[model samples]
Every structure is written in C-alpha cells, then in structure tokens.
Target: MKAIEYRLPKDFDKSFIVFQETGKFFPCPWHYHPEYEFVLVTKSTGRRMVGDHIGYFEEEDLVFMGSMLPHVWVNDAVYSSGQATHPADAIVVHFLDNFLGQDFLSVPEMEEFRKVLRLSERGMALKGRTRRKINTLLKQMPPMNGLQRLSTLLTIFDIMANTQEYDLLASPKFVQNFQYESSDRFRKVTEYIMQNFDQDISLPEIASVASMGVTAFCNFFKEQYRVTFVEYLNTVRIGHACKLLAENDRHVVEVAYECGFNNLANFNRQFKKFKNMTPTIYRKTLAI
Candidate 1:
C-alpha cells in the first residue's frame, strides 16, 4: 500500500507543465509528487482518494493539490474491464512552489494566491461558477503561449483564491502523518485506516500502525498534524457518517453505530459540529 513518489517529465524550454490525458482509465495509483497540481476531469466517473480523504468523483471534478500531497482517482469497475463506450479525458497543470519566484506570492497583490497555496495542503475540490471559469480558461490555454498562457494561469489562481465554492479535502491532523512518507509507516497507516475505519479505531491501535508507542505517537502526531489523535479519528468517523446519511436508507442511529459512533447522542453532537447540521437535516438536503 506504499504510495509511489512520482517524478514529472522535464522540458528545458518550459517554465511549467500543462497537459491533457486521454485514456480508457486513470492509471496512476496512489502516489505523491513535489509539484503543486491542478486537475480537471472532463469525462469519467470514479472515486478519488486524497490524503486521508476518500470519496466519489465524476465529470467536472476539479482539484488543486499542494506539493507532496498524495492523490488518485480510481474509475468505476466498468472502465476497468476495457469495454468502455467513451474514452476518459482530463487537463492537468503542474508547477513548483517557487515557480513564480520565491517572493512572487509574498507581494501584497498576490495575498489571495498565497492563501490558495496554503489551503491546497488539504487539497480543494472546486465547485460551481469557479470550476466553470477554470474549465473555460484551461480549454483556452493550449493554443496560447507566453503572456497569454501566463495571464490565463494567473486568472485561474485568482478565481480559485476568491471563490467560496470549494471543499477542503483532508483534515489538517491527518495530513501531517504523510509529511515524512519515505518510510512505509505512513503508507501502512493510511491503508490500515481505510480498511478498518468502519470499526472503532482506538488511539493505541492506530499508533501501533504508525509503529510508535501510544505516548510517543501522540507527540509525533500532534507535532506533525497539529491535531490530537482522537480529533483526527472523530473527523474520519464523521466523514463516513456523512456519506451514509446522505446515500443510504438506514436509520440515523443505525448509521451512527455503523460509522463507529458509540451512541446516538454523541453521533448527533459530532455530526452537528463537523457538518453544522443534524443527520435528518443532512439527509433532507441530499434529497433536494
């Protein structure tokens, strides 16, 4: 389950990388790279795994990921069988943190752009009008060069930074665990969590997955992710509960227990804290 650290292709003449991918399926496995990445899936339906987050994805899926963040999109089984009716397509952009010069983003004019970069550590799923704007610019980029290319890119960043229509992909606490992923320990932790998050995940158990004593693990996790181990667990459990509440017909209490929440009261409280709504209200919104 260890993720591959990917290396981007180099071109001596280029300042950044912008390209399109068309295929029967998205082939890259769970992987990480140093360059910040922006991607738009124009045609496909699948599930996306970003950092500690797991969720479904489909056409118009647009995401921006920070340097060294891990991500992947696994297409549905129909695409895997090689008998798909339509080819998959996507536009991807890659640039280094200092691609625009170390001080470029520090300028006051680039303040919002800086925030986009910082928030990208958790990844961002662009939505609504912002996604539409970026999609249009990306389509216009391939045929343009020099200032045209550069200006369009800046515009895309501006839209992303100013727009409110986006979802942060991963929890701050969970992201730190991936900071030092050279060792397989981070990989093991992620794989173990994804496989077993449905059941109760205790601090001691998850700490063992990271190969550290519970106390040492606590210190390490806190320093790395800036969140206590228990808070991270609750975030994961709550995220799972949200999916079930929106997509399944189960009773609220049943969804609570199934997502590893101990009692109905606690489940309701955490759901409200995490989602700012009750389970029934969340379900009703989904129905809309």
Candidate 2:
C-alpha cells in the first residue's frame, strides 16, 4: 500500500519532511517512491532489502536510501505475532532532489552537499562518530521551524558530506526494476527464511509459500539470484553466525549450530566458501 495510503508533506512546501514513526513492526511492504529518505532505527532488528541485496539489521541502524531504490525494513515476523515484547520505532527524514529549487545545489557554496547527494544515490549507512552526530541532529529537528529547521537540515547534510564514517549499502551496478508479482512472491519466501533461518525448513514447504513446485521454485529462484536457494539460505545463516561470533567469545562449533548448520565441519566449509575463512579465523579478525 502506497500513494493514497501513506500521508506525506503536502506538495509545494519544499523545506524538508521529518517525523517519527512507531508500530508493531515496519508496515510498508517492499516498495519505492520518488523521495530520497534517511531513516534512523531506534528499535527493532530484522532483514533489510536494498536493491538486490538482502541482509540483517539491528537496533540503532542509520541508513539513507536514494529516490526509487526499492527497499524495505522487514522486521522479524515475531514482532507482528505479538511475540515481540516491545514495539518498533524510527526517526525518518525525506526530501526531493530539488527541494530547494533545481539550481540551489548547483551553486559553488553547496559543493559538499552535492557530493553527498551523489554518493547517497547508491544508499548509505552512517556509523561511528557520524552516526552519533546525526542521531543528535535528528532528535533536535522536530520542534524547530523556518530558518532554524533549514539550518538544522543543512548542518546534517554538511556533516554527512564531510564524514568518512559511512558505508554504501548497495553495489554500484545494482539496478532494481520493480515487478509487483515477483516482489510479492519473494516477500513470502524471504519472510519465511528470515523468520526461520535458524531452524530446518523443508524445500517443499518453502516452495509452497510461493505456490510453486519444488523443482520450478528452485530453478526460478536460482535464475533470479544466480545462486541456489540452499546457498542463499546458507549465506543468510553465515551472516548471523558472523554477528554472533563478533559479539562474544562463543565457541566455533556452537556458533555453527546456532546459525543453522547441522555440523561443525559443514559450517566451516560453507563459511569458507562464502567468507574465504574458517570460523575460528573469522571471529579472531572480526571486522565486519
């Protein structure tokens, strides 16, 4: 649901649009719109899809997505099932490319802001000191008006332009051309994976989620992603495994099973295939 379903700042008022949203979980289905967006996740953890990339997200995640990039912050399904003890919350900011007029950013004084806009086209994740600075500015924005609001917005952009403490989210080559049918099908399949990736899920059960036979679903999914469904599931598991490994001194074998691998040897082999390192070496180097 989009367009008429969601309220936005009225057209012709071009300063900026900022607000706080809270819910059982992020409810917007995987969708895209023309506004460039910056979101601060104050609470919740789940999968985030940007362009063709899929990955887990957690609390305090701050990200910028370019106009029409097709993305979603899908909370773990339990949140909607009344299993999550707390609700989700976020501070969201949005604006158009030419909100200040087409020529405003072309001026020499706005050079850094222009660079930020360009880099943000690939999507961005602000981390470390930059994220801390933004979190402050975001909290300070809602009560301000007129010149104060504009000033706060400029300061936010200026900080983002100057910082090296950010990572781009999507690949440079990634392009998403939306097909509603495919998005709907994958939504079911991916939600199933994200909700149950730690448990053993049968291929037939997963195929049924998309209303396809196992062979057809396997072939279709592989062609779309260029990796088998099992491989993709392993990648997701390995990602969570890396998170666990980084957070504590969990033993490698235990981490493997915690992430859905049936055995230590198999987990090691898959981890090596995806990450080019064994679990022991991975946790030791833990830079991700």
Candidate 3:
C-alpha cells in the first residue's frame, strides 16, 4: 500500500542513479519515469510488471526499461514474511535519454546504439552471458570515478545494443504521458489498490484515498493510466491469480476465491479477458 514511491538523493547531479538492493521485497507500485533504467537482479523470484507484460522472474534476471514505461518488482510473500532463502539483490541504474546530450546520438557512429535505446521503449529482458557481465559491472559502480563510470555505462549500452535475446515487454497502447502530477496520483491510487485489492474495493473507496471524488478519480485514472479503474482492478486480480497459479497447485476455485472474485464464473470471465486464456489452461500450459 506504500504506492510506487522512490527516494531521490538531494543534489544528485550525476546523469544516472545507481544502487544495490538486498534483504527487503521492495514492491514498487506501477509507475513510470522520464529516464531509462537498467536493472540486474542477483537473487530473488517474483512477479515482474514491465509495461503491459507480466511474468515470473527468478535469480540473475536483468532488464532495461525505457523512458515512461511502468514497472514493478513484486517480491514473493515469503520474502515479505522474512523467510527468504537468500536476500534479494539488485543493481539499478537510471539515466535520462539526453544524459550524454542530444548530439551523443546524432553522431553517425552511435546510430546503432540509438536504435537499441529506442527499442527499449517497449522494455527489454537481458539474459545469459550479458546478464553475468552486467552484474559484474554494476557491482563495481559505486567505487568508480567519473571516467570509469562513463566507460562502464558505455559498455553496458554496447552490450544491450548488440544483444539478440532481448524482447519487448509492453504493448503500444501501454504508453502514457510522463507527467509528475499524474504519476503522483497514480502512485497513491495504485498503492491503495494493491493493499486492498484482495477485498471489496469500491470506486468511492479508492477515490477517497486519492482525495478525489469518484467521478474525478475515474477520469483522472483513465487519463493518466489509459485504463478504467475496473480494468486496473482486473489486471491486479489476474496478476495475483498468475502468481497463485504458478506457485501453488491449489484448486482453481480456491485460487479464484482468494483472488477476490466472488464466483468462479466471473473470475473465469475476467481472467480469460485479461490473459486470453482460462486459468486451467494457463496452469496447464505452465506445467508443460
């Protein structure tokens, strides 16, 4: 329920923000930033939302998110409950498109890298050898000098530019304007929704949390996120269902009930609508 909140350091003048994470399940609510991001997960597993794409993630996962793409790392409940097998570890890098200046990409020599960065608008997953190399680079970031940092960043970008294993994560419709005011509102609303999404969440209930009336909240949500409140709710439910279906062999009806759908029929309908497949099929497909 904390929403997708991030803390920026005061007077942080560098073009990029870099850090390593461990221990906690930092479940950032769905939100976007104007800057691009590179993240390498060292140890952990959970549901990851990058743009419109949702999937399971495990150790050594790496991803690159373009400007204005919404994402979150929802750690498993075991981590939240302090029973994690290993502390979660991640190296995060964030920088603006113009961090190296507009002319940086204008240089004829950098065109290929420019196209690679553009492809990131849909988000990308980094895998295999590239993941290990990036992890080593990120681990060395904190102690590096300005020139060293630039060298490392360029190396990371070069690898990403040439890699063929990456895939786009979000759909085209998932793009949204990256305005601070709208993003703030979204953070608040999404936090409230994630916290109480498993229960009966009404428009009035969420609207109050956003400090807006129901009508205003509806318009605000749609305008900012391009999805109705109901749509978002169903997305959240389906996300929870996905986690359950993948992690547990519980009966389908039980998973439906726990995901907040009152009846199996409605749960099935909404799940199929969002997933383009039924829950049973989804589970079975994962099995095979």
lDDT of 1 by residue, 21-62 (tens): 889998899899999998889888887878756657788889
Query: Model 3, range 1-288, lDDT digits (tens) per residue?
Result: 122535445224576677777776765676777778887887888878776566678877888888877788878888878798778788788887677787776787776677667557767887778777887888898678777888999988787766676655554334443223335766777667767777899889899888899998899877654458887777777777877887889999999988789999999998778666799987875564
- Candidate 3, residue 278: Cα displacement in angstroms equals 5.4
Error of 1 at 81 (Å): 1.1
Model 3 TM-score, all chains together: 0.59
The best-first sequence of candidates by lDDT reads: 1, 2, 3
State the lDDT of candidate 2 residue by residue for 1-288, as single tens digits: 222224376435546788888989988876777788888888888877665345567888888887777787888888877689899888888888787889887788877666667556557778999999888888777777767868888888889777778766554334323222345887778778877888898899899998999999999887554457887788778767866776789788888888888999899998777656687876664342
Instruction: Give candidate 1's TM-score.
Output: 0.66
Top lDDT prediction, candidate number: 1
What's the CA RMSD of model 1 in angstroms?
A: 9.9
1 or 3, greater by TM-score: 1
User: Residue 98 lDDT in model 1?
Assistant: 77
